[model samples]
Target: MTALTLIRHATILLELAGQTFLVDPMLDDARSHDAVEGTSNPTRWPLVGLPTGAAEVVASATAVLITHTHVDHLDDTAIAFLRDRSVPVFCQPFDVAELTERGLPDVRPVDEVTHWRGVAIRRTGGQHGTGAQADLMGPVSGWLLTHGGQQVYVAGDTVWCDEVAAVLDVNQPQVVVVNAGEARMVTGDPITMGADDVFATCRYPGRRQVIAVHLEALNHCGLTRAELACDAAAAGLEVTIPRDGERVSLFQG
Candidate 1:
C-alpha cells in the first residue's frame, strides 16, 4: 500500500511500490513570506532549519512531482538541490520550459495518465481563481495517484470551483490532501481553500479520509489547524489536521 505523509505546505512524501515520491518540496530556511512579516510559525522545529538531508531523500525518490512553479512550491534552493539528481521531475506543461531553462535534464510535463515505479498518476486541470488571481497564479493543476489498488488526490493551491469538483467526480480518491489555508487579501475573497471550501471538498460524495494543511506557515494564509479540525468535525467530515513532521498511511480494503 502507498503511504502519504504531509511534509509541509503543498509538500508531501509518498512511499509506494518500493520507491519514494516527494511532491512540491518547499524546504528553504527563510522560504516563506510569513517569516519576514513575523506572522506565521512553523508547527515543528525544522531539522537544521531547512530541508536538510533533502539530497538523501531525493536520491531515493523514483520521481519528483511538481504541480507548479510558485516560490513556495518550487524555489531556487529546491531547483538547485535537485539539478544534480538523476530523478525525473514531473510538472505541468507550462512549467517544462522553465525547468529546462533552469538546467534540469529530465524534466517531463504531466499532461495525462502516466506511471512511475508502478504508481499511476493522472494530471487534471485546476482553476486558481475567478479572474485576475488566476492569471497571476497561472495554470494550477491537481493529481490523482493510483497505487496499490487505491487512489489519492492532491489538490494544489486552489479555491472551490467546478474543476475541483470534476476531479472528485472522475477520480473518487479515497484520501485527499487539500491546501486549506483560507488565505485572503485586503480586497478579494480568500485565495486558498478556506474552512468552508475545505468542508465542501471533503463532503464530496465518495471521499473517505481528508487531510488539511497549508495553515499557520505563511503570511497570506491565516487559518489555524485546530480551527480547521473543529470546523470539519462540526461539519461531520472525517478529517485529520496533522502536525508538522507527523505521518499517516492509507491501506486498500
Candidate 2:
C-alpha cells in the first residue's frame, strides 16, 4: 500500500514501503514575480496555502525529490526548512552542482534507476517546452516510482512531448501525477501541459488513476482544479483533482 497526498502546487507527499518522499515543496505565502513574469498584482495571483499539517508531514519525509531548481519548486522557505534536516534531496545530475552551490546539505544527484528505502525510482529526461523555450528552461526530469508492485509517474513541469509518452509506454504506471495548469506568458503558448495535453496523457493505456496539480498557485498558471476535473471527465478520463491537504491512497498486491 502507498499513500499519496497533495501538499500544494506541484508538492506531493508519498508514503510507500515505509518511507516518505516529498516533491517540489513551496510552503511560503509570498508570490514570486521573478519566476513568473508579467504579474503586477501579487494579491490577484491564486495562492494555494500549505497543508494543515505540513510541518508534521515534512518532518516525516525520509527523502525529497526535486524536479528543478525553480524558485517555486525550491523556494527560500522550503530550502530553510530542509537545510537542517537529515533527509537526502534527490535531483537531476545537472542540478546537483546548483544545489551544492546553494549550500544544501545531503543533496544527491539521481542519474539512473535507484531505490530510496524499498521504493524503486527511475529518473528520465523531460522537456520543459519545444525549441527555444526548452533551451531557456534548461534540463528537467520526471520520476517513476514503483513500490508494493504499483507504479506511479510524477510528471514534473513539462509540455507534451515524445519523452513523456515514452515514459508512459515503458513504465505503464498505475497512477500518473501531472503538473498541468496550462501555464503561459503574455508572449507564448502554455509552457506546461494544457487541458488537451493532460487529457491525452491521462488517457494512455494502463494508467489506472490520474492526479492533476500545479494549478491556481501562481499568476501564470490560469487553470483551476474544478476546470481540470471537468475537462478530464468530459474527455472520458478518470482523474482526481485533490485539494492542498487531500489524501488519496492506492493498494497493490
Consecutive 10-residue window with the lowest summed lDDT within model 1:
39-48
Model 2, 1-253: lDDT tens digits are 4878888789889877788889988877644434456433334332645665556756878899999988778776778778778899999988988888777799988888887777888887777867787788788888889876778889898987898889888878878888988877666566788898888887666546777888878877878888888877787777778887888886543
lDDT of 1 by residue, 1-253 (tens): 5777666677778776777778887776643343322224433322223433556555656778888887778766678888888888888988998999998889988788788777888887776755786776688887788877677788888888898888888778787778887866545566689888888887778746777877766666778888888877787777778776667877654
Evaluate model 2: give its TM-score: 0.92
State the local distance difference test value for candidate 1. 0.74
Candidate 2 residue-wise lDDT at 151: 81
Q: How far is 27's C-alpha from truth in model 2 (Å)? A: 1.3
Instruction: Tell me, by TM-score, which candidate is best.
Output: 2
List per-candidate RMSD values in Å: 3.4, 2.2
Model 1 scores a TM of 0.88
lDDT of 2: 0.79
- Cα deviation of 231, candidate 2, in Å: 1.8
What are the runs in model 2 whose C-alpha is more than 4 Å off? 30-35, 38-46
